[model samples]
Target: MQKSVRLKSFELVAGDIRDVDVELLHALSISVRWPHRPKDWELFRRAGHGIVAVDGIGRVFGSAMWFPQGDNFATVGLVITTPRAQAQGGGRWLMDQILEQCGNRNLALNATHAAYPLYVSLGFTSEAIVYMRQGEVQQTLPALPTLGGELNELPSDRLTEITALDERAVGTNRARLLALLAKDASIATLSRGGEVVGYSMRREFGRGFVIGPIVAQNAWDAVHLTAVHLKNLEGRFTRVDTRERDGVFAEFLQRSGLGVAETVTTMSKGRRFLNREDKNPWVYGLAGHALN
Candidate 1:
């Protein structure tokens, strides 16, 4: 539990997610027009440390979260402030609480163009561009690729492999979060000679299913992995948030019926930590803008 700090008429409480009212948090999200649903908020709470600002009347006005990735890295996200709370120091106070909790670890986040200045004021610099794409799946999509590796359902026994590959690709140890996601998400893996080479996971999120965290050796392999995940979702709404560098994969998604919806700039503070070794240019897609 975090000590509560009083600021003007508001109290900044280190979130005890179990006790923090999800309904209140959901209401805050809706007030800001954030896409996260109540279930998504639960997932974030379960996976990270958070802080919420409550007014004297006990209404949630602002919220922020930071997911620890290994010992030296963390990702901050879900920072929101009610319209009435904006420009009143609530957002900055929430950010300060999460940063203080994160200590000296490197921090990263996806910031909207509107919020980019605030993050820059906190010493963060743009690292990459992330685009959110979504649409109803087309009924007549191109056939899945037959080349590259064979795609199959990710086996429970491959948890170790999944974590290792994810760390190498994403530059962070998120085994605990991955474990939780695996339980509720449909995951597919591409294997060559019985060794897993790439993977993708699709799960119900927001308005529909979101396919992401796609990790692969190259653009082609990523397409293959993503195609396998999309095959089962034909005619259903699907969303994917991908990096701008993965333009080919993004094009493929656009061709398959999804359209670019919005863009966010990925920013980092302190030293950049994502490993992009040539052996495996892995992070073709992110788990989600928030999670990344």
Candidate 2:
């Protein structure tokens, strides 16, 4: 018998991401040094639809997911391709499938440095820079401004209280996504003059906990909202994704020991995806990179 026979080249095909085993998806992500865990994959699956690139033997080589926000907007993410397959046009193929599935809906995504050129070539416009911050929470948090409102715990059942505010900040009605997040997240809201002004959620993610979807009107409010969760997360690994480059909110995260771990570019196609105005609610912290 011949030993060590060379195998013939295999063709890649698109498959439903949900059909693959979670472990395979986990391995595919691990191959790229991504921090996503199996649980993260499950959450993303529940939140959106995706496709995986696989060969005849069922080995996954790449994946792409798009989350619909309302009827006309969507966010594309989890676009990954094995290093060995990147130069073989696997990434672009996966994206073409995603774009086709997303239809004519305006699309948005956060692109890593390696993936930036591909997205640009696909006609995505630069929008903003997102700072990926993570580290052990400080035992002592930095000084925060005087609480201008009442900070109170929000039961997951009362998710409606924040949906409108969240929609205002993200420009979409992500009630379904927020409801899914609230199922496992410890939620807090700031109230002033008998009105809910801001909110934040702390939940278990990749390595530890992530505090995010933090919606507020100003940096001071954002600081107070974040501190409410950091106080309890002292000395534990925590991550926060935000587009804030400077100001009180960004400074607060640095002071709390969550330094910038990496950066990703926020890009959009079709219509503008990010728009900020003074004295209006804004996304101080993102729910997740994929969810954005």
Candidate 3:
């Protein structure tokens, strides 16, 4: 594989799995239809870090892209295997290598029903419940926190600070992941103070803007930031996803006016990142659809 990565078929790779080739990934995305394409897959790897699993022929049969939540904890999932390459441990091999790669770090991942068993076999347990709420942009940012707000275009420096704050809100640092999302022309943010206290980045997914990563200092902050962000984009349809909010920001959106929508499980395996000394929970928003 290494020798072939040096070859023409697979040698066209660049950056990391996060941002390798949107076209290639877009091709792969067709394979990931059901749950929708989680923005972080494109964004996380775009942040300029991830593990690539290339076949000797240079085809990316399977890969797991991960971005660190901070210096210590890391959320590493987004395991993918080509449709032709599914089963037969192709996906598991990619995950195994990622688990080994992120051994000591507080690793997190979002698992699908098909792969949940693989994750459990690897020592992961369920973490949170993800709720998918679909509706028009409510056109309201709920009253909460500082209500501090600022609009930001990615690649702009403010996102850097917001990325840090987002980690604090979510307990995992993923500067690399946020960086990835910034590449898309549509990525943007809203902050309170000089610092980026909250943010929302979305893409023209399907019928509307699929709200990928929404972060803030708290529940209200996150929801507020999301509302303000969405209201700005008129005429476009929208869907905002929320993580299971049982922690400090328990059922935040439940009050934010988002209905139950649909439910998805945030599955995990291996060592968990709880209220440990190394990991801190400042999670104002979710890292991505899966892990983080």
Candidate 4:
């Protein structure tokens, strides 16, 4: 399809799809391959969802979904547009559909350097800055805090506690989106006695891994969980995208031998979701973009 010089009219079809090939999606030039492979979309679709865009011929051009989070918050993510379908109202169409469906939640996205301009133009504001780190694994990392929190792998029956804790740490929780979170492999938790405190999750990002929703007592709590999780994968060079408030996590990353690969501005549109009272923190690692 030829790019439209100007979109005279735009249309969007609102719905959900669980199976999106992140590699194929990137191959279409809808996204950049920071880590390609659709690991999280399955879970996002299983939860609650929002919008998808299709051309007049009824083929998917690009897509976006507004995922539900606890505390009545929602996040917009899994956004993509095909190269053959670019500039012909695909992006704008998906945007309109998502904004309308998002319905006043504090929407969030871990944006790429290329897409920040479009996000700003669409009325999303950066709540925090994120710096991505790439390349080889460092030989040493900051020690995990003992912090008196008992650590345990999440059990299948107790996932609700983990999800509930996620809402407490972050404004929203994407527990409903990915079925894998409920699975034994991708989940871990930290607590005191039986009381749930913090949790961590990992999903394959292309060939490597990405850590998210590493919720904890605070930034320190989350970082502790993050390090413990990363330690399990010490030899792998994983990509971590975290929303920064202060320089705490960034410093921790630097000490671990990681550098700032890229900086992203997390933007939101519509009403600000007010689940968490405090604004700033050291840094926030996403559980999943679809979940916020």
Taken over the whole model, the C-alpha lDDT of each candidate is 0.81, 0.92, 0.56, 0.60
Across 24-53, the per-residue lDDT of candidate 4 in tens digits comes to 444433243435444444445556564455
Model 2: per-residue Cα lDDT over 1-292, one tens digit each: 2111111354777889999999999999999998889999999999999999888798888899999998899999999988777766778888988999999999999999999999999999999999999999999999889999999999999999999999989998999999988999999999999999999999999989999999998899999999999999999999999999988999999999999999999999999999898766999999988898
Candidate closer to the true structure by TM-score (higher is better), 3 or 4 = 4
* Candidate 3, superposed: residue stretches over 4 Å from native: 1-22, 34-42, 48-60, 135-155, 160-164, 179-208, 244-262, 267-271, 274-284
TM-score against native, each model = 0.92, 0.96, 0.66, 0.75
User: lDDT tens digits, residues 1-292, model 1?
Assistant: 5456555556656554456779998998899787778998888888888877775566787788899888898999989878865876667777887889899999999998767888998999888888888999887776555567688887655678778888888887889888877777888888889888888888888889888788888877888887887878888999888885446677788888888888999999998855567896578778887788
Best by TM-score: 2
Ranking by lDDT: 2, 1, 4, 3
Candidate 2: lDDT over CA atoms? 0.92
Top candidate when judged by lDDT against the true structure = 2
lDDT of 3 at 60: 57
RMSD of each: 2.3, 4.3, 6.3, 4.7
Instruction: Give the C-alpha miss distance for residue 287 in model 2, angstroms.
Output: 0.7
Where is the poorest 10-residue window by lDDT in model 4? 1-10
Q: Comparing candidate 2 with candidate 4, which one achieves the higher lDDT?
A: 2
